[model samples]
Target: MSAYKSADQYRDIAGRLALPSQAFIDGEWSAAAAGKVFENLDPARGTPLGLIASCDGSDVDRAVAAARRVFEAGDWSRAAPEERKAVLLRLADLVSAHAEELAVLESLDSGKTIKDCLNEIGHEVPTFFRWYAELIDKSFGKVAPTAQNIVGMIVREPIGVVGLVLPWNFPLLMAAWKLAPALAAGCSAVLKPAEQTPLSALKLAELAMQAGLPAGVLNVVPGFGETAGQAIGRHMDIDAVSFTGSTEVGAYFLKYASESNLKPVGLEMGGKSPMIVLDDAAIDDTLVSSAISAAFWNGGQNCSANMRQIVHTKVKDAFLDAVVDKAKALVVGDPLDPATDLGSMVSEEHRARVLSYIEIGKAEGASLLAGGGASAGLDGAYVDPTVFDNVDPAMRIAREEIFGPVLGVIGVNSAEEALAIARDSDYGLHATVFTQDLDKAFHLAKRLPCGTVAVNGFSEGNVTTPFGGYKRSGSLSRDNGTEAMDQYLQTKTIWITLK
Candidate 1:
């Protein structure tokens, strides 16, 4: 009954894109130094898309060397801010022009729904570049007041070469989050796309070259995290590394940085975010839809996905029933289908991990209200939208990051109990509250120890606001908005004595 594209249609789309397979370095595409390659599979069909270059530490070294050369040459690093802005704006235009191609590649590569790929990845990717491009000209340094005729000035400068490690979910969008700000600040970068999803990053690198970015300004290396990622973290020449991945890997980046160059590392790591529905909430169709979307969007692979849904004990049963009904209604099938509400997980390995977590949830005494398994009749890595009731705050599924389409509902006696339940987590990236009471919304918003809290809605944030986590969810620096540029910039103080 779904209006999904056939296999042949998808294949024709793929052929038209002709996505790049080689790693992009110094404005050119080339094979890995060792000529090793890895198969990139379409997660929905489990078919091989192509073999991508499998880079290693040596490739990372080459990329870093090239980036360093460009940084020293001042082609981009010393260019005028307006000039950098112009190039980024042009790149944004190119991204818009090739939106359909990129959307096809993204859905095929990462198994995200084609609708989301086009809207979130394809359309939103250019916004980051354009936002940062316009912001470049506005982020000026300050002239500070000083004692008795002595003039002091503070100026921001790029931190030389940077290393960026991206995650599998929202590949190109996440890349834009880091890439836009770094380039706007005049920093050269060596980017390592996750091995599972590297096609879009490589494609973006090609587009950057076409947009007039100087050679070495942006480089993409695709490989295993243990090799290229570790090399980037440990490389003494890489001034800083901005990473978005697991908290465990984030800790490793810190260790590598400390053990090597002691470079400043910025991490946008994992999250076990929560969504609280107060008894006084509107409880309309919109509220129910938002709750379901928060848990199942992007197949729940989002780092900031709300895994825990805390509800008032009074309205718990009704809310649970509505959520369960909605979960059961989701269409899980080919991601390329415009009507598909849910798509495959990023890979078979990840699907297995999510399935195991469902079993664990059942074993831990959480009642499975709706679904706890893969979709019926689907050969791909498709997981049904799952909801668990009576999930204990102490349970692993409640406390840890599942990174799937699994929602754990916990009932609370009062607002106090809800606050306690939401705060008791190692990860604090994003949370949402559904309530009509203004006082209650602000009260909960002020107390939640997360980086962002949405009242009466569930969205990460807009371009103007900053995004990052508290505690283990992220580093001191934030991503998106004007604050993101700070991560790639350093300040210097200059003082002059007047006669």
Candidate 2:
């Protein structure tokens, strides 16, 4: 079956959409505390979408206070695990029911393709909620053997109120990533959706309430990073923070925690991941598709985007030929259209930033292969997926995180050279290795130093596997699977003496 509705159908939904424009705090949709607002625009047309509530420190305080109140009052936070699970499961169903509306909203606001948005909103989003809900009661505590007269027990408890600062790239999916586990763990939360994309978050709050989530259990405050984000970071009442964004911004959260309440911070920061095509690997359609998806999916705005391609000299030519051909054939047009393989950058500013990097790649002597700049006659920030070959390991384009639809190919003489170049980055969130030989794949995979290494393909694994980084790319805390619950729970020990 076709994966999406017609462009006219999507536009009709957008035209009549009830754009959320306020903070959802304490079960009410209210304006910013200071009555300030910011313009949210349609990235595809550069037109004003709506006026989002420009929350400041005051709004953050209000949201956190409400979360703390509900948590302490034994509402959602103290509910039975089954109760929380049921509520979350219902929320998942609600998401699926409204999938088309949300997918279109995301595509219009964030400039993500409607097909991708549907897959996430319709399938992945609900799956995350259901997965965490199923895990709620299955998680077991531990008992310790002690002296004959004494008994010891270890159990987990909710970590109280948490701050979830989301990124703009995967608006609802990232919300699902953090919220599912946090809410499933029975912790109240204050969410600060990125100012660039906050409408879906506000809408999510409305849905959570409709799903029987208690008042004050979940809140969303929308505003700029310096105001709403900073307030959440420095809020003394918040018990923990889970952030997914840039490396530079991740550092600031750590500082905020240190300077404020010292709440633990979980960060999934940026990466300069490499897609290594070893000499033994085939230069077939699989490798080309994986390489293209790694670099161009979501326009390469992902934190773990494999913008660096370290291919062996033996197969570099064929790999480049195949990938460039595929890149050129990718349709760069309307995100609402299912045929559009690539869409606009999230905003005009981001498009300019990416175009500048293309200029930088040229100045640094990287050979342009396919794509370079804006798609002709496109209204908004649409960009062609640019590929560059003959990239040196030392060049800025190869080393930095451009977070655009720009891929650079660096030729490596051997698997060892590829490993060395891949490991040279300060970040180690993810890496992809393509090799037919089992021993070589295992060798490179084991020594890659990243959090999750994909063998023979490009993947970040499914919800069953933990996702995070090893070095500066992430912290000790992880997301997805059972590990994600650890971010919102605390382990406690109980010792008793028998009379």
Candidate 3:
């Protein structure tokens, strides 16, 4: 009797796509300096998808050197803003051209639904580049107030070699957020993608090169967080480091940058955001639709996902019922399935973490309104959509980030109490204030201590609008319209006298 199971015991998509297993540096893909590798797992099935190149300190140096070379060469950053604009535009076009393939790959790797992947690749990802492309030349300096004889202009220049560390939640979208503006502002970069989902970023580097981004102008290195992430933070030649991840790690990078070179650090950290439903809010269709979007979209992994819901006591019961009903109706399954509304978490560990939080909710006197288990027959990493009612504002479930399909419903006495509860968290990433009254909406909007506030509906912002957080968020402002490009630039003033 054979004790071993056949290879067919597990699902395989290796033949579907030959995943890149190398660090992309100076326009070429190669193994890490140490010849190490990391296994990326399929979140849906809790199986090893494949081994990808794992880089460390030496690898980080190579990438930084490449970026530095490109910066010094001025082949990309020194190109005329018009020409740079053209290249960025072309890059966006290429992303659009490969939108289908990118979406499939992202879905396979990230465990997000194909529909969401398509939306990211087709819409969010490309829009950043396209918007920044036009803004390349437009991102000029403003003339500071000065005496006529002593005129001065705060001209923006490339921020030199930048290190962009992107999160796994929305790999392509987050990378685009950094890359588009950084490239637009004439900076070369070394991109370190989340180890869990590095495929899309490597693919994107290839696309950028094909669109005429010069060799060494961009590099992608995948590795462990302690190794590559820290290396990027401490690299001497790196002028700036922009990151999006948990607040715990963001703090580490912030300190690393300060200790390393006092290099400017941009961090977009964690959130326990509140979604306020006012007494006058439209409940039946519009309010329910917005609530569903806030709680469950993107599998509740979004940094800006409405984790905490504060409903006015008068309408709390009705709101909870509506939210639970809608959440229960969501289809959870394989990401490749077009109809699947909710996909698996990024990994089994994350899935377990989420479920544990659900358990915590129950133990802490919160009510499980709907969903609290694995799908009956699903093979991949599928967790049922879950909602908790009678949750206290102080409960761990309500305050901490689960990053799963779990919602915590809290009732507040009034809109003022709602805002107070919403503002009580350590995070100020984002919040949505739903109300039919304009005065109430605006009042709540101004009072909420988040980087972005959505009135009447969830925020549907374009690349031009600013999107960032307040306290404990980060040092730099991001997504503020064209201002996103500012992080990638430095300022220089030149004085001259006409002969």
Model 2 lDDT tens row, 370-405: 999899999999889999999999999998889999
Using lDDT, rank the candidates from best to worst. Answer: 2, 1, 3
User: Which stretches of model 3 miss by more than 4 angstroms?
Assistant: 1-15, 143-151, 497-499
**Which prediction has more favorable TM-score, 2 or 3?**
2
The residue-level lDDT of candidate 2 at 459 comes to 96
What is the Å distance of residue 343 in model 2 from its true position? 1.0
* Residue-by-residue lDDT tens digits, candidate 3, 130-246: 888898776557776766676666677888999999999899999898998888888989999999999989999999989999999899999988999999999999999899999
TM-score to true structure, per model: 0.97, 0.99, 0.95
lDDT of 1 by residue, 1-499 (tens): 1244554676578777786899998888989999999999999999998999999999999999999999999999999989999999999999989877888898999999888877865568899999999998998889897888898999999999999999999899999999999999999999999999998899899899999999999999999989889999999999999999999999999999999999999999999999999988877798899899899999999999998999998889889888898899999998887878999999999999999999999999999998899899999998999999999999999998999999999999888889999999998899999988899999999999989999888898887889999999998889998999888999999889999
Judged by TM-score, which candidate is best? Answer: 2
Q: Is candidate 1 or candidate 2 better by TM-score?
A: 2
Q: How accurate is candidate 1 locally (lDDT)?
A: 0.92
Q: Ten-residue segment with the worst summed lDDT in candidate 3?
A: 1-10
- Residue 312, candidate 3: Cα error in Å is 1.6
**RMSD each, Å:** 2.0, 0.9, 5.1
lDDT of each: 0.92, 0.93, 0.84
